[model samples]
Target: MRPKQLNFPLNPDYGTGATIRRVSLRAQSHRVDAHLLDNFHEMRCSIVHDCSIVTAITGESVRIPTTACPAAVHQLQSLVGLPISTPIRDFYAGGIARHHCTHLLDLAVMAIGHAPRPSTEILYEAEVPDELELPVPMTIWRNGRLVCRWLVRQGAILEPLELRGRPLGTGFAAWASLVFEQDQLEAATILARTWLIAIGRRYRPSQAAGRPARDNPEMLGRCYAYSTGPVETAVMTGEKEAHLHRLQREA
Candidate 1:
């Protein structure tokens, strides 16, 4: 039997507070487990790998935006036996992305890369306030240290002259690759993703369960459930778990 979906709130009120997203990755011997938690979703993924190839993969959507979202977990099986030596994005370039859940795929890939390391755990925390009218600081912390801080207004970066005028979406990963060192690049990538995701806080999608994916033009074709084309019919699950205060409490 599939595991039961679990729900618990890190914050009682969803859209009224800061939005926090946390990622945790742990490695031991041949296995690695990764988890992602935010206001809208909670997902877990794990991989068992040999020194060079992945042997097993598992993913679970603990909390999600739509009913059809859970079906994407089965797609993780297709990634078993995949070679870990190559860049993962190369596979996404080949159209493998539209077949799986985006967050789960990212966690599984992170696990594969982490399997060869000594037993360790890495944590990433991101915070984006609900206020976006004037410039606001968006930040990311890696392993408990503040690693990224960018002033954002609307959806574009306004402070840090080098990053000024860059929108938080599309080309962000590519542009960040050219700007940061390896470690900083990874943190910036998380920050960029969370910033865009935080937008949901203002719209409060959790209350609109059962709404069709195709109705949201901006999210269409972005991931598996949304890419189902004209027949796309995934709806919100109406179950939201927020940790919007977790980061602040830890501070």
Candidate 2:
């Protein structure tokens, strides 16, 4: 059974480019003991105690499972170099969910299931590219005759790009307000929600009917969820008696 409640906030930008994922679960005799190896450029997968193992051939990205079907072993190594941004859920829905080496895929799913909340990563920062070119002036006409000419996006009248400095990526409302030159009590909601999705699978992982999270509110910027349950001692403490007792009680 899955945890009754999961809290995953966006991991800070530690600036570590290496893609990494980790997960651990415990309940009574139920346990998931697994490991996934992803080195941005290659992947290796293994699971112990269940008698499955995937090991990369020396000096090659190919992984051959020792106890699985040879064909399945051949496919295990194919996961190498998958984009770090690849959606593990989508990978499942795309027919990999029940592959020959299911433990490998399950490990990926478990990592994703324990991942940080998508909503918390909404804040983004952008820098002015060194190649940013000033827009050329464009002529505009009122009624029929030309009334005035102004730099593109009104660059001549607009604040200098550098003068504007780099604003914090947070405060979408403030950004919208600045762009519109007015309070954005309405557009702020739309912008923030749109941003969360543009950054997460919550939107456009597929079509409207295919998204996994259909329960999200129509207006997500203002919505939240909280759930809890009876407690149990943390596993891995070597307290086997307490572990089984609490799991039985929870069950």
Candidate 3:
């Protein structure tokens, strides 16, 4: 049997009448599992009011106002937690809503360096699963070197990173907020390194042991640079860009 469809309000001000019907038209067409449809329907209902109705000629169409959508509100809330200066809040919000994950990371990097030209040099190697991985699991790399790694998993015993500093747990949330809110690569890199150092001091990992040589700050800036220095340089020098452009032309 086909599962019942759901609907949600377009504008909350319409009381109960402003909802738009959202049928499981796509799921029905695909023959997806009934349980999945039901779960989806339930989730939609919880997020907003559903209003599905039947019409004689058209059958059914969900009526929603299009003004009071949850998407805008959700996006607004996400931006609220960021530490952007008031003047650029809207700009950052729009960027976040429209950007892909990689682009967002790029923005963070640029923000850190206060670079005027947007940079897309940093590439994300993989998506690290937050819950399954270690609290302080490595999540980001620039070039071939590690830029940031997880240092503390939530719910784990708290460790002290510095001799007289607070527990590592105390700073995790703030650090995470700064990271996610970054609008440029340089900023993200700096934040990532800071997070790593905090983790290293707390956990005393061999990876975090030494300071970098003076000639190569990128190579030895921190543990991550040692592994990712060459990669970062290659990207910065336009070699990576040229190679990518060549591949695209060939394709």
Clash statistics: count for each candidate? 0, 0, 30
Best by TM-score: 1
Q: lDDT of each prediction vs. the true structure?
A: 0.74, 0.25, 0.24
lDDT of 2 by residue, 20-75 (tens): 11112211111223242221112233321111222221122232211122233344
Off-target runs (Cα >4 Å) in candidate 2 are 1-74, 109-251
Task: Report each candidate's C-alpha RMSD, comma-separated, in the order given.
Answer: 6.1, 22.9, 25.0
TM per candidate: 0.85, 0.21, 0.24
Model 1, position 44: C-alpha lDDT score:
97
Error in Å for residue 73 of model 1: 1.3
Q: Per-residue CA lDDT of candidate 1, range 33-78, in tens?
A: 9999998889999898887888998889998887778888988998
Candidate 1 deviant stretches above 4 angstroms: 1-16, 229-231, 241-243, 248-251
Question: Candidate 1 vs candidate 2: which has greater TM-score?
Answer: 1
Clashing pairs in 1: none
**lDDT of candidate 2 at residue 82, scale 0 to 100:** 41
